[model samples]
Target: MPQLNCIAPKPEHGSTSDPVEGGLSLTKMSSESQNKAVLAFPVQPKPLQLPLYPITLKFEEVVYKVKSEQEGFCCGGTWGTKEKTILNGITGVVCPGELLAMLGPSGSGKTTLLCALGGRLSGKLSGKITYNGQPFSGSVKRRTGFVAQDDILYPHLTVTEALFFTALLRLPNSLSRNEKLQHVEQVITELGLTRCRNSMIGGPLVRGISGGEKKRVSIAQEMLINPCLLLLDEPTSGLDSTTAQRILTTIKRLASGGRTIITTIHQPSSRLYHMFDKVVLLSEGSPIYNGPASTALDYFSSIGFSTSMIVNPADHLLDLANGISPDFKHPTEQSENMELEQKSLRENLKSSYEKNISARLKAELYNSEINNYSHTKDASIRSNRKAEQWCTSWWHQFRVLLQRGLRERRYEAFNKLRIFQVISVAVLGGLLWWHTPTSHIEDRIALLFFFSVFWGFYPLYNAVFTFPQERTMLIKERTSGMYRLSSYFLARTFGDLPLELALPTAFVFIIYWMGGLKADPVTFILSLLIVLYTVLVAQSLGLAIGAILMDIKQATTLASVTTLVFLIAGGYYVQQIPPFIVWLKYLSYSYYCYKLLLGVQYSEDDYYECSKGVLCRVADFPAVKSMGLNHLWIDVCIMALMLVGYRLVAYMALHRVQLR
Candidate 1:
C-alpha cells in the first residue's frame, strides 16, 4: 500500500492565488513547495465573535448500521436478517467561516452523513458529533439550520407570507411581530427574492415561482434565524448551470458572514467546484479523499492518478472516486481483468485515506476536546443562548398558526367546486322531499337519516389528507424546536372548525324550511347544531386515521370502510342487527347523532296519517322505534365524548411521530 502525506499547510505571503470568478474572494495556495501545493486551504479570516455564534462542527469515527432482512433462502436458512452499515468510520472537521462540500455518487451516504452532522439521525448511530466542542443539545438545535433537498413550503402561500409565518413561529418572543416581519423582509432582499415575494409557491400541478427561486426561498427560510451552522443537502440539485452557480454564490456569501456551511453536491462544474473551501469525496460509505477543494487534483496526481485531458476537476475526481482511473488505456489492454482492477483501485484509495488523513483528523478532534471548556466559559456566548424550552408562548403559537392556517386552507375549504357540491346536494334534497304534510311519517324520517349519512363521510374525506400531506413540513418545523406539538394540533383543529361548519350550516338552513320538517326556529337551531357536531366528530376521526397511517391512499381507504360500517349499523338500514355484533352501533358516532337529530324534529304524541285516513304515532315508526329517543341526552353526551376522544387520539398519534 502507498502512503499519502497530504496535509493543508499555512499559507505564505506570496503564493499563486486562484480567485473565483464573479466577485468571490481569492484563494491563496503555496506554489513554491511541492508538498504544500498538494494540500492547501484558502487563508480564511478569523470569524468575528461579537454578535454571531462562531462555532466549529466536528465528527469522529461516526458509524451507522441498520438491519436488512433477507427474503430468499440463504445457506439452508429460510429467512435471515443482517446488520448493514450505512456509514463506516467517517471523520471530518469544519471550522466556522468554511464551506465544506460532500461529493459522492448516489447511495454513497452523502445525505446520511449530512443528516448525522445536523443531529437528525435517530437509531443505531455511534459517533462523536459536537458543536463548539459541546454535545448536541436544544441550544445547538436552535443555532443550527438545515435545508433539505426537497422544498417544503406550503404551495398555497406567497414567498413573503411563507417566511413571515416561519419567523413568527420560530423566532424568539423577544422580537415583536413588526420586528419579525422586518427580519423577513431583510432575508428576502438578501436572497434576491424581492421581485417574486408575492408569488405563490406552486407544486407539480400548479405554476408559481421558478426552480431557482424556489430553491432560494428554501435557503432564505433557514436564513431568517441567522443560524451559526447551516447544513443544506443539495440546494442546487435540480437547477441548470447558471442557476446552480447563483445558488452556490449565495451560499458563498453566507459563509463569508462567518457561518459554517456544508452541502452535498453531485457532478458540479469547474466553476461550481472551486467555490467550496473543502471537499469530502465518498465512495461506498467510506471517504476516499478529504482535503482542500482547490488542491484535490494535485493530491490525486501525486498518487499515480492524473488526468491528461482537459476536464472539470470535479468530474475527474468523481471518476476516481468511482474506482475509474482518469488516464485512459487502450481498449484491448487488460480488458478481461477490468472488474478486478477497479476493485483493487478502490481498496487502495480507501487504505491510503485511512493511513494518511485519518490520523491528522483524530489529532484535531483531540485538540478540540481540550478547548471545549473555554468555549463554555465565554460569558458573551452564554448571554446569547436561549434558556427557555420554546421561543414563544403556547397562546402565541396558536394565534400565529390559526391565522396562517386560515389563510392557507381558505381556498381549499371554500372553493367553487366544494360550494357547488354542497349547494347541489341541498337543492336536490329540498326538491325530493318538498313541503311534505304531517300525514307522511316515513318520508320526513328518511330525510333526517340521509342528512346523517351525507355529512358523515364528507368532512371525513376532506380531513383525512391533513397530516399526510404536511408530514414533511411538520417534521422540518418541529425538529427545529419551533412550537409545542399541542399548540400546532389545537390550532390546526380549531382553525378548521368554522370553515368545516359553514357549508353544513348553509345546507341545513336551505333544506330545513324548504322541506318543512320543523317549522319552529328552536328545532331548526338544534338540528343545525347536531349536524355541525357530527361533522366535527367525523373530521376528528379522519385526522386520527391520517395521523396514525401517514399515507394518503391507505388512510382514505380505511376511512371509507370505517364510515361505511358506521352507516350500515346506524339504525336506519338494519333495524335489528344480530345481537352478537350489535355493539358496533354504539361505536358508530353516526348512530348517536342520527338519534339526536330525530329526537329534535318529532315528539312522542305527534301523530301522522299512515294510510288513507288511518293514523299512527311518530314514535311507533319502525326507524324511530328501533332508535328510540328515550335517552337523547346520552346520545349527545356520547357524541361529545367522541369529538373530544378522537382528537386526543389524533394528537397522541402526531406526538409519537419521530422528527428527523
Candidate 2:
C-alpha cells in the first residue's frame, strides 16, 4: 500500500544575502529515505496538551434507525399532516483524528443527520450511536458542539464580548480568564481571524464587520470547549474561496489533531477534496456513496463512467449517481435506484461505522466502571452533565445576557424628545398648580382629563416604535442562545426601571413641587409611582408589539390606532365605550394606567371646566383615600403581566423569526 504523508519538513533554502530568495533544488533519495518521506493516510497532528495517559475520544456505529416527523405545523388547531419519515435508518460513526464530510445536495437529509446526531431533532429513531461507548441523547450533547449555517451574534456587542461570553458559557470554571483569553487567541490565530476582532456583528446597515470574520467568530465560539465531536452545517457557504479554504484547513487540522469533525459542504475544491479522510454522499434524502474521497473516483469508474474535468464531482454525484440524476427515468414518477442506493448507502454507512470505530471503542461499551445503573444493560447510558443543566439553562444565560444589555445601555440614545416633552408638561402643570387651588368645577374637571389623556402617549410611544429596533438584536441573540428570554425581560424591566422613571417622574416632580397637585408628600410620591406605571405599561406593550408584529411600518400604524382606542375606551377624553366594548378597556394598557394616574393626580372638590361643560369631576378622580378606583393597582398588575407574557412569547418566537 502507498503511504500518504501530510507532514513535511521545512524545505532548505540556499544561503543568499539578497532580499528575494531563489527557488529550491531537489536531490534524489534512496528507498530508505523515500519510506521516511512517505506520509500517513490522514496526517495526525500533535495535541495542544497531551494528558499523562492520553485522554481518548472513542466513536461507534449506529444500527438500524427510523425517525418520523408528524406532518403538521409545529403548533396547531387544525388537522395535522401525515407523519413524514426523515431519517429512515442512518448508521454512521465519526472517530477521532478523522475528517468526515457529509456530502449532499439540497433536501438530501444531510441536516437531519446532524440534528438527529446532535439530539435536537425529536423523533423516534431506531438506531444506536454510542459516544466513547455510551448511547447518544440530550445529555450526550453537552460534551459535543454544533454550529448552524447562520451566524447568531448580537450586533450591539463587540467581537471580544461575544466570543468571551460564549467561552464563559462553554468552558469549565476551572479555566482562568488568562487561559480562556489565550485559548480564544490561539483559535483565532489558527483561523487567521485577528482582523475585525473588536467590531459589532449584524444589522440591516450598521457597518461593523465582514461576513467572513463573523463566521470565524461563530467557529471560534464552538471551539471553546474543544468537544471531541464537532458538527457544522454548510460550513463554506457565504465565504469567498480563500476564506473557505482557510476554514476547511482549520477543520481538517482539528480533525487530524484527534477531534471528530462532521460537517456538510455543498461544493468543495479539489484541494479540500484531498483533505477529507472519508466522505458520505446524499441525494434526495438518501446516501449514495460512503467511503474515501480518493477512492470516490474509482467507485464511479467501476460503474463505467469517469469524472469529467468540467463538472464538479460533488455536483456530478448530486446530479446523477446520488439518484436525483437529471438522466433519471422515473417509473411512473418513482425511482427504483433511489431506494436501492439509499438502502445500499445506509447499510454501507452502518458497516463502515462499525468497521472504523468498533475495535478501539470497546472501552465505551457496557463497562461497569463508568456506567451509572446497577444493571449491566443500562450501563452504557450517561447521566446528563451537571454543567448542561445550567449550560443549557436560560437563567445563567439570562444574567450574562442582562449584563450585556446593561452594557448596551451606552448606546440606547434615550430620546431628547421624551425629556423635553416631560419638562414642558411640568412647567404647564406648575402654572395650573398655582391657579388650581379652590378651582371652579370645570377648571378641576379639565385638569383631571388632561392628566389622563396626556400620559397615554408615553406608554404608546414606548411600546410602539423604539422597541421594534431593539427587538432586531434581541431576536438574533436569542437564536444564538445568548441568554434566556425571561432574564432579558426581567433585566430589561429593572434596567429601564430607573430610566423609565426619568420622564414621568420628572414631569410629576416639577408639577407637584411647583404647581402643587397635592399638599401631602406621600400623595406626591404615589403620583410619581402612577407615572412610572404608565411608562412600564407603555414600554412593555412596545416590546410585545415589536415581537408580535415585525414590520415597523405595520407596528407604527398599529401603535397610532392603539393609542386612540385606549383613550376613548378608558372613558376620559371621549364618551364612555359601548357596554359590549367595555372589555376592550381591559386589554387597553392605557385604561388601567390612566385610572392609576388619575387617582394620584386629583382631589374631588376638584371640578374642572373643559371646552366641554365638565369632565369626570376632579373630586371623582381622587387618590386612594377617596378614589374607590383602586384600578391603579389593577393597571400595575396588568402591566406586569404584559411584561412577562410579551417576553416569554418573544423568547419562543425569536427563534422562529428570521433576522435577515
Highest lDDT model number:
1
| Residues 510-569 of candidate 2: C-alpha lDDT, one tens digit per residue | 766665455687877776766666666666666566667776888777777887887777
TM-score of each: 0.89, 0.68
Over 1-660, each residue of candidate 1 has an lDDT whose tens digit, in order, gives 121122222222233321100101122212332132212222223310113555577888899998998767557644878888999898888877789999988888999999999989988999798776566767667767899999888888899999999989877776656556666766888899989998999888678999999999999988877777899999988899999999999999998777889999988999999899999999889888887898888878877788888999999888877778886453656665886777788889898888877787687667656755453445324433543467789999999998999888867768899999999999989999899777776788888888899898899999999999888988999888888889889889889887799999999989878887879989999999999999999999999999999999999999999999999999899999999999999999888888988999888987888898788888998888899868888888888899899999999999888473
> For candidate 1, what is the TM-score?
0.89
TM-score of 2: 0.68
